[model samples]
Target chain A: AQSVSQHNHHVILSEAASLELGCNYSYGGTVNLFWYVQYPGQHLQLLLKYFSGDPLVKGIKGFEAEFIKSKFSFNLRKPSVQWSDTAEYFCAVTPSAGKSTFGDGTTLTVKP
Target chain B: GAGVSQSPSNKVTEKGKDVELRCDPISGHTALYWYRQRLGQGLEFLIYFQGNSAPDKSGLPSDRFSAERTGESVSTLTIQRTQQEDSAVYLCASSAEQGTKNIQYFGAGTRLSVL
Candidate 1:
């Protein structure tokens, strides 16, 4: 069984502040990583995904995540966040195209 | 339709009653998934269907929870004798095929409240 962990439960930041949310997973084999965001009442939407190749994967809405195999981590980051970026973010992991296991999620609150 | 669709966007049921949740995947999609999102909890995998093959029910919490998918189209998740603990947002998602790289588009979800 694969497990994902998100260190930050809630994050509060001012507009234009840099952001980083830590995510770690326990899976030795090949895995696909994803970051999904749920704004207020909207459905969960993909932020970015990593299948292979470059460790740094850029996603929608100026968000990016870096996959570090050795560290077993794929952390989401954004240079500057806006008020619109306030939402709940989730990190999901799938081993070899199987079902995904998601982290508890991190709630981001960007104050304007 | 354009994306995965879940019926009864909000369901209020009594404890000990059975409730069925429906999911209609996007046209032509071969893979569909059901997940539960409890308040402040992560998305919990429930069941997954890939074409006409047997569904992967490994993620189902207990025997009381079961799901069925008709071919590659609609799916129904049934909770027998629902309990208060079963209350949560049941989400449905679908992808192009069975692969990790494929993107899964999610529906707004069916919020089930057992009171």
Candidate 2:
């Protein structure tokens, strides 16, 4: 069974601090990657997605992820985060079949 | 219509009782999916519906769980004799089609508590 691993469970940082959330999936076949974010009381929204193209993909709200096929990792990164960026981030992957497998999720708290 | 909508935002049921959760996908969505999110855990895939194809039951945790989708419009997930372990938020999502590139829009979710 394919699975996603998110190493960071929770992370606290001050405003303007750089952020990186590690995500790795265990699937040998071709796959699509996505990053979804949920605010305090909002539904999960797509932040970014990677189907096929350049390894680097940019998402909404100043976020970007690099898909490293060799490492089987697609980590979310932001050069600087704002206080409003506080939310739960989830990494998900799906093969051509369309069933997505998600990681445990990483809770990011950006303090001002 | 605008987005995926789930009925009975919160459901409280006693153990051994059966409960039904509903989901209304977008107007023209061709794919619908159900997922369970336990507290502090990632979303677990439950069942999937794509157009007229037979629904995928591979992700269902047990036989007591079943889901039905009328065409590509609405879906209902039924839990028979629910247990405390079944306590979790049930989320519904819909996409344009059954493929990796299609983006899925999610609903607020139905919080189910089996007492």
Candidate 3:
């Protein structure tokens, strides 16, 4: 069975600070990666996804992720974050079988 | 008509009771999945149904938890004997098919509270 691991449980940053959330998976075959965010009182929304082609994928709300096959990692990044960016972020992966696996999630708090 | 819909937005049941959560996938979607999300936790895959295939039940937590999907439409997740630990949000999502590129549409989810 494939599994996903998130390096951070909670992250606190000031406004305009750069952000990077690590995500790693344990799949040996080709995989699809995704980043989803859940704002307070909101449903989980897709941030970005890596299916194939380019290793760097950009998503909504100025978020992006780079897929590194050799490292088995797809980390989410933001050059600068705003207070409105505070939310819970989740990294998910789907193996060739189409079964999706999600990491534990990381709670990001951006202070003004 | 826009996205997946789940009924009984919130359910409160006592321990040892049975609870049934319903999920209505997007129109024409051939694949539906059930997932559990405990408080402050990530989604835990439960079951996946594609058209009429046997259904991938590898993620079901236990025998007490079973789900059934009629054709390619409505799906029901039943907990035979609920426990306090079963308190969580049951989320339902639908995709076009079993592929890596298909984007999944998720419902608001049914919050289950076992007291």
Candidate 4:
């Protein structure tokens, strides 16, 4: 079965700090990757996605992710994270002809 | 609706009782998916509905769980003889279609508690 692994369960940082959330998936086929964020009281929303084209994709707010095909990773990165960025981030991956699989999720806490 | 909408928002039922959760996908969406999120856990895929047919239901834990969709708009997930372990948030998502339009829009979710 395909699975996504998010190494960190939680991360804490002060405002303006750089952030990186690690995500790796176990699919060997042509895959599509995505990053979804869920705010404290809001539903899960798309942060970014990678289907094809550039390996580096930018998303809503100031979030961005790099799709490293060789490493099977799509890590989310932010140069300066704010308190408003505090939320649970999920990494999802789906094969070209398969259902999507989500990681356990990483809770990011940005302190002011 | 403008976005995916799930009914009840919260449901509490006793063990052995049956509970039905409803999901109204965004208009024009042809793909609907159901997931379960246990406390401190990731989203667990439950079922997928393409139009009115469920092509993939491999994530259903057991026979106690079943889901059906009405055409391509609404879907209902039913839990029979609910167990305490069934307590979790049921989420519904819909997307326009496969391929380049696979980005899914999620709902607020229905939090189910089986005591």
Using Cα atoms with residue i matched to residue i, what is each candidate's TM-score against the true structure? 0.98, 0.98, 0.96, 0.98
- The backbone clash count of each candidate, in order, is 0, 0, 0, 0
- For candidate 3, the per-residue lDDT at B51 reads 89
Error of 3 at A10 (Å): 1.1
Off-target runs (Cα >4 Å) in candidate 2 are none
List, residue by residue over B1-115, the lDDT tens digit for candidate 4. Answer: 8899999999999999999999999999999999999999999999998875645899899999999898887899999999999999999999998653499999999999998
**Mind giving the per-residue lDDT tens digits that candidate 2 earns over A1-112?**
8999999999999999999999999999999999999999999999999999999999998999999999999999999999999999999999876589999999999989
Give the DockQ ranking, best first. 2, 1, 4, 3
Residue B46 CA error for candidate 1 (Å)?
0.6
Q: What is the lDDT of residue A70 in candidate 2?
A: 98
Candidate 2 Cα deviation (angstroms), residue A109: 0.8
lDDT of candidate 4 over A1-112, digit per residue (tens): 8899999999999999999999999988899999999999999999999989999999999899999999999999999999999999999998988889999999999999
Worst 10 residues of 4 chain B by lDDT: B48-57
Worst 10 residues of 2 chain B by lDDT: B95-104
* Chain B structural similarity (TM-score) per candidate: 0.97, 0.98, 0.97, 0.95
lDDT of 3 at A102: 92
Query: Chain A TM-score for each candidate, in the given order?
Result: 0.98, 0.98, 0.98, 0.99
User: Across residues B1-115, which tens digit of lDDT does each residue of candidate 1 receive?
Assistant: 8778899999999999999999999999998999999999999999988887888999899999999988888999999999999999999999996767768899999999999
Once fitted onto the true fold, the runs of candidate 1 whose alpha carbons sit more than 4 angstroms away are none
Give a tens-digit lDDT track for model 3, residues B60-94.
Answer: 99899999999999999999889999999999999
Q: Which stretches of candidate 4 lie over 4 Å from their true place?
A: B52-54, B99-101
